[model samples]
Target: MPNPADRNAMLEARRTLKMAQSPHAYVRGNTAKFYEWLAASPVSRRVPTGPAIWICGDCHLGNLGPIANGQGSVEIQIRDLDQAVIGNPAHDLIRLGLSLATAARGSDLPGVVTMRMMEEMIDGYAAAIHDPTSGVPGVESDIVRSVERAALGRRWRHLAKERLDAVEPRIPLGKKFWELSAEEREALTTLFAEKHVGAMILSLQGKPKDREVRLVDAAYWMKGCSSLGLLRYAAIVALKTRKGRWSYALVDLKEATTPIAPAAPGADMPDDDAERVVAAARHLSPYLGSRMMPVRMLDRSLFIRELTPQDLKLEVDQFSHGEAVRAARHLAFVVGTAHARQMDPATRTEWLAILEADRRGTLDTPSWLWESIVSLSGSHEAGYLDHCRRYALAA
Candidate 1:
């Protein structure tokens, strides 16, 4: 039996309700369950365990987006690192394929379209791994174009309004932002005062190393699906400028928990959860990792980073047949680029060769990928319906 107190029951109930809404939602919110099923499936054995590289364990559509680097340039990359680990890159590929296939089903596209998407996905990934210096293939989807344009035009005022509910500097404690406890507030105050934390804040704005950092306001953040019950907080900090002006930065502090996704058998990774997340982020998402620092707060490990307005999630609520094909190729290239960076030249060549071989009678996609998505999609649909039935009964 599970310990009820280990998790917040009310929040778990809310998570269940969110998962029951649709198959895509279920896939996004139930990564742990996905890993459990993957372990028990025969397809897991057939997929070659490529080089042990840091991988985004939950490489779904929603988690891939535009992230602005410290230099103020934005590019599409993996945005979430909660489940990151040094593992077989194949897991990320399959997870991403599962996500895209589920979205196609939600869009009511025929099964043939998904097959094509998988083939295109492999093509995009292989292209990146083979030629590391090549630019990402252009995607002509309107959604992609619009998101890029919006990210480029974002500024501090835009982030203030979206996160703080206003253009002012203080975080409002209500609805999305709950009031922090006494202990949490004190921990946050001390955290910002630390030398390393102050350096991280200044690293983003290119401020002087001696500049003072102050915690202006903070709140218990009520966000994310799978991470709902975890300790998450948003802090507003001000960096004093030489001209006596104050610039504010929004910092996200999230507790690092043990990953449900299995790492490669002999993979060497940090034992500390916070350190593990930071290490993986540094390898896979330089834009986000460069601005992040791991710290201890209230005796628990946490990862803290400054959030920029240009950091936006790729939202694919609906997709046309053409859009679906283009998205799969483009997003797979993004994930592949992350993985390819950590691989040596020899390893990259070997991995690409393995992926290209054995295309299962003109399908032009690895047989394991096709089989895995078909199986996982069916399993997730059944699980989604079962979840809805239970939720309805509980209510």
Candidate 2:
């Protein structure tokens, strides 16, 4: 978290340094720029607008991962809902294409491989749109398999070790977790005292519904690249599991800001930012949505969710040609199913036809998808370089 003394300057410095690290990292952080280019470029006119539904406005590889539900079963889904909205599904496709293309480039894969991966991406998405009940795909790529294995074996102890560096039920004040103000602590305690909040947390533990919950520890959490300056906190809540034992769970409280990702024109959305996020999340990712609660604290709109050990983001730094292609298809299928669930049979068929109509001879993918990725790749490379230079000068 940014120090209250110089919050903006500190946050800007941290965000600039993180984004300057790599092109893929920059793509993940610079979502506003991606939308700006899409809106202003001539390609925007050629893009087909699909049915208005809840979409992950930032559908990058990093945003899609293994998310666990109340029962602790994990599945590949969109893990972040901070930028979700009801909008054209095409925006998600373009954003995901840019993400995979950048990841391929960062891995030093051949340009031909990147082209083939895009085709497979479309194929994977179309397959799910044809059958929404396919659910999460079987693990095919090595990177995905590795992450899946880790997620399956994780428990509360694993989460504690990683997040707190100990098995004790407390958030250690350190780099990732900082000390909070007195007022902030009091507000969080009051927020957790509500019956609804306790029920949500206890839902994961299989404990008595009426069990009393206590605020064990909390801190200002400095997490994520894009949401660096936003109000975020890591809270530990404890409930007595039986007469002699207590159970603990980690809860994440993040402020909901107005999304930079634009919604479809005249789309019906909740006026409250937190409500909009939770509602869109329920449509886009059920496991996560079922665990989320919208709340107001310290006069700010915020959403709280339990952080399970099974919720792990895919950390794909390097990829072989085969892994790149397989990953493209698998992750796209995940996003496709999310979108397909929101469409009727007729709407799915119509959108699928529109997607296929732009393909030319010998090319399996849509021409506009290919063109958008090519244009955005070049633009982001330039943007990434300029960002590094600016950071260097500032340093």
Candidate 3:
């Protein structure tokens, strides 16, 4: 159990942070309590048979998005792992389930209808992971909307040439975000910028020319509303050997915390984020964490892996009525898989039933209500952000 004092303090901090217009900022300090929660629960830590990758901790509708691939294929896949922990299959599901519930509250769709979608998604994942042969008809354990490799690789080159707002390296921001926190900037720049670039060149596979070697470049990027004030930097590591030829590596560092709920806020316990991911991956699904590299340095949690382009999802506002439901259905399976992955077989079965029940009740609702929820959420988000901004200026 977490200390009583710590829990109270976190709740108060969350209020302050929320008042500062930072709903997008992730701040889950003392999240270790979640691990403790899972342990005490009746969930099993056994891994199912399959290839696993590092599970995203905070996977939800908003977190899924597109990434460019080295091959130019714009694949869709899962992203975000602030609360990610190495544990069971379904840790992220809890977040997904609640998000769906909260999301539904804002729309005109009856709560029952949204619940049905959630149920379908959950059952889909159960069948996919447990009995692939059975062929459950849904999306779970799948990277939400990731694209293909060859295509992503092709898209990557094209994107590189164009000006990407955040994902692609097109802008020439020569280190202005650094002024915000000079101490953090110096510490990170010294670690990642110049030194890592030199090391990357030697890691090159074949020999080339020294004349071919190019110095790596570094720049600060400002994006992601939740992570707005947090630190972020990227470096272009191009490799060259004794012969004149070139290859490149992309490395980045960013704030790893999640947006704080109005009920809680503050700097997250630095090491907890990565630890949660590793522990959950180790316990719930080893395959997911296989290629995922987890490390923490300079009091920050970091995960290193190939930036996947296959992962993708459409923006929420972009979706129409039918499209939103489709999105809900897709998210359902992913979240279900996450929950079942963590809990014991019995618990999984029970959750499956409850979620199914939630789904069936929605069989008769009007779809317009669903759309209304999206609007409500947006309004609430705006209202909350405004409230927080006032305090930020005060502080």
Please give the CA lDDT of all the candidate structures.
0.87, 0.88, 0.42
Candidate 3, residues 247-291, lDDT tens digits: the string is 554555554554221111232333455555445444333333332
Q: Per-residue CA lDDT of candidate 1, range 147-260, in tens?
A: 978999999999999888899998887657777778888999999999989988898989987999999999877686655557888999999999989999999999999998
Rank by lDDT, highest first.
Answer: 2, 1, 3
> Which regions of candidate 3 deviate over 4 angstroms?
1-57, 65-77, 86-94, 97-116, 122-136, 139-154, 158-171, 174-215, 226-230, 241-244, 255-272, 278-292, 295-301, 305-313, 338-395
| Residue-wise C-alpha lDDT for candidate 2, range 60-103, written one tens digit per residue | 98898888889878888899988899998999999999999999
State every prediction's TM-score relative to the real structure. Answer: 0.96, 0.97, 0.54
Best by TM-score: 2
Q: lDDT: which candidate is best?
A: 2
In terms of TM-score, how similar is model 2 to the real structure?
0.97
- lDDT over C-alpha atoms for residue 223 of model 1: 81
